[model samples]
Target: MIERDHPTLSVGRQCRLLSLSRSSFYYRPAGETELNLDLMRLIDEQLLETPFYGVRQMARHLRNEGHAVNDKRVRRLMRRMGLMPIYQKPNTSKPAKGHKRYPYLLRGLRVERPNQVWCADITYLPMRRGFLYLVAIMDWHTRKVLAWRLSNTMEAEFCVEALTEAIQRFGLPEIMNTDSQKMVVSSRVV
Candidate 1:
């Protein structure tokens, strides 16, 4: 709670004391117009069927469906809704600058035991309202899930927690492999 008019504390001082941003403390959400909301719903439904649609393509789609929308509006709506075209592109998952790169050690290595090789990965699970991230650790040889965690954000903490739980429960593997997206944190754990 924020006291707009306190006896001694100013609003800014109160916000600072509470560790809250002044802008956020005074922010008010603007309601979306009904027409725009309807268009957003249409765009979301269309996105479900065509996950590869970009701004221009989506605008064309909406136009074809008898909606008076342009690329700029579609782009803004997509940005607001956090809708991005899912496609294969070069350099999509590059490592952060100055991060150490590890050699790919499992090129031809054969897994013979349960603890020989373990793999971990994080993937997005889309839901009706929003999305969640799933981090899973699995034994390569046995194809068994050692540990898994679900989070609403893609923070490294959840991935690290999942890895720690797996290691604590199933013991350390000879090699733990993970996708490049999560390699930065998993490397620290390994």
Candidate 2:
């Protein structure tokens, strides 16, 4: 890998030596400037420490610590960082406009055996250079990962692939549980 080569070799030189075009070494630049990356890193660490901090509060905290950051910039950075306020939702989770949604029939129901209930979740994994979306389906009774898949794009195809694999291997469940996240739920249904 180019990243594994001698530290003294410039990336352009390495590309030439490997008979690769500099353009082919395509990597998206860090989303922020080096200075901004430092700020974002600090903000992320601080947010993890105190998730309740809003943009205003975070800006105040940073200013108190001598980081001359404003609330606007902090808010933008937090948004880019995927930080958001957490709150409970009272209404039923929203679904796609045309997709049919089934009522929660398994509420208060007991699941005691394999294939009784399956739960799936999709989460975002942030990396230094990019991000990935991960989806996993687990048997509620056994607490085992029946299938999982990762993708750089948050599309429905990967979710379908995971579900299809699980079905091919373990068979379908009595009921599949998942949040109303559009990509996940939609893929499973259609």
Candidate 3:
């Protein structure tokens, strides 16, 4: 777990040597109150059941369930959870500076061959004590997973590592699809 041997080395190279996901290295524990944790858990479960519920509906549902939560609290919790009702709406999530926003390039494009298009997604990993983030690449045509990596931090570099490994193994795809998440579109890594 010590990188002292390689003085002034790149972090990604160090991470590769340890057989550990870079995310596992930077995961931070939630510092919210126990009550807020309870509320977040409740809100997460409810959101899973009804992703369309906005803060107003979530607050009402929580109140009906006797949680004593208000809309403002619910809104904050939802933002923390990265939960959004999937629908057509303004792009509320913004990318970081200099991160290239790749237009959705695969709208009606037919993926008739392997590696024609690939998609990447980052997800949260629930643990008994804490959580980690997982990034994965998938082939659009065969629905096959090409590469995946997990990390404890929200840094974009872990996603870059996953992307690099995917490209090394399968070569670059004609199109790579990802949500508006900043990590996925970072030009610094590309």
Candidate 4:
């Protein structure tokens, strides 16, 4: 925390003591304007109805609703609200650059026994207010869910926790698969 008008301490000194950057200490977040807020509300309501609407579609919808807005503004507001079209889009599954790529090892291998292969996936569960991220680890042969965890944010910690729990309960599998690009192959798995 930073106090602007401290009794004796200077702002710079307070920032240094708190291990915070001077710029961050001085920075204040800009609030959305009334028009932007109204647009955001409309976008949210429309998103519930048409989850597949992209920037262009959203802009057209707003225009039809009598709001004079451009695609750029709609795109910015959608990004700010963390909303994305739910439909499948091309090139959305690219792996991160500089990350080690592992070949798909289960192409021809048969999963004859439980724990032979395991798969994990993360999905979003829509709720009344927002959505929750669900991560699950399952046995490939048996199709049994070994562990699951729900999180408000889509961070790797919950997925890692679920994997850890599954391994602890059922022991390690011969192979593990996931669609996430951020998953790193540990030495134990290798």
Candidate 5:
């Protein structure tokens, strides 16, 4: 540690003892350039309108608006501003080839009874160390979670197990519904 106000050691002697260059010690960090600041302000406003635009698209948009910006530069400024594009991230819900999609039965149907309509959905659960997948079977009318299961893996077995428990506890519903994504995602038989 260099003590500039120390009565004993001179500033030059302190620098020598610390093995530090004078220029480096005197150097203060200067923030982003003026052009970068203006660009970032424009980017901030445009980001609110279209949050799905990624680095390349954002750069192209800026270039189209007569701003000389590259993807790398746009990416850097966006990163510095802590901004990320909102888009569909790849997940484990991709359907298999030639899978038959079923029509939604409860679209206009009035679910008057508890067991009249049932639905199941799957989502991710945030954990301290990592994440766990959760599948819940709910009664449409009661809005109750009849059965649920948590699994570290996204296998169909856990989802099926939850559904089986719900069906065992209560009689079969008139209509069975789940997210369309769960068609080929969870189980083909469910």
Candidate 6:
């Protein structure tokens, strides 16, 4: 720490001793402007409603709300604020290392009824700081979300809870399908 008001050592002397530039020693960073602060607050609110909104969408949203904003401006603000939109990643269909491949039983069979086949997926809900894991049970044919649960950690409780809720409400399906990773985690706990 450079003490500016040192009785013996001058600010210049202290900076030289520390090998610091004189300008850097006296530099004071300018924080966000008032307009930028207001815009950031609005962006944060919109992010809460839709975590998947990218720079383009956020810029459009701000423009629609009567704010003179562009994608470039929104992109810079979001990058500075450490905000990122969650989207699908590539190669998600590929299985992990040492994971066994299962036969696609539904390939030849047709799923017409709602309860004929059910599927569950474990996805994470993005947040500002961290994210929460979500387990959703859906009817395969109807594409309706029967039940969903959120948890801080990826464990079997939330998955089992969602499955339980779905079964209780819509009854059991003839077949239940989920990711292999999910089955492993759930089997370990359940």
lDDT of each: 0.83, 0.79, 0.77, 0.84, 0.82, 0.82
Task: For model 6, give the 10-residue run with minimal summed lDDT.
Answer: 181-190
Q: lDDT per residue, candidate 4, 73-149, as tens digits?
A: 99999999999988742232455678687777777888899988889887877653567888899988999999999
Per-residue lDDT tens digits for candidate 3, residues 68-87, read 88888988988988887643
TM-score of each: 0.49, 0.47, 0.46, 0.48, 0.49, 0.48
lDDT of 1 by residue, 1-190 (tens): 7798899999999999999999999899987889999999999999999997888889999999999999999999999999998864433255678876677878888889997888988777765345778989999899999999998876679888998998889777878888772232333354
Sorted by TM-score (best first), the order is: 5, 1, 4, 6, 2, 3
lDDT of 4: 0.84
Number of the top-ranking candidate, with lDDT as the measure = 4
Q: Kindly report the root-mean-square deviation of model 5 from the true structure over all alpha carbons.
A: 16.8
lDDT for residue 29 in candidate 5, whole number 0-100: 94
What's each prediction's clash count?
A: 0, 0, 4, 0, 0, 0
Per-residue CA lDDT of model 5 for 16-109, tens digit only, reads 7889887777889999999999999989989999988788889999999999999999999999999998764437678778977876655577
Cα displacement (angstroms), candidate 2, residue 141, comes to: 0.3
State how far residue 15 of model 5 sits from its true place (Å).
53
Model 6 ranges with Cα > 4 A deviation: 1-69, 74-101, 181-190
Q: Which stretches of candidate 5 lie over 4 Å from their true place?
A: 1-80, 83-90, 181-190
| Candidate 6 lDDT tens digits, 1-190 | 9987899999999999999999998899999999999999999999999998999889999999999998998999999999998765432355657976655656577988988878888877766456778789999899999999988776678888998888889877877778763222122222
Instruction: Give the higher-lDDT candidate: 1 or 2.
Output: 1
Q: Candidate 3, overall lDDT?
A: 0.77
Between candidates 3 and 6, name the one with more favorable TM-score.
Answer: 6
TM-score of decoy 4: 0.48
List ranges where model 3 is wrong by over 4 Å: 1-94, 181-189
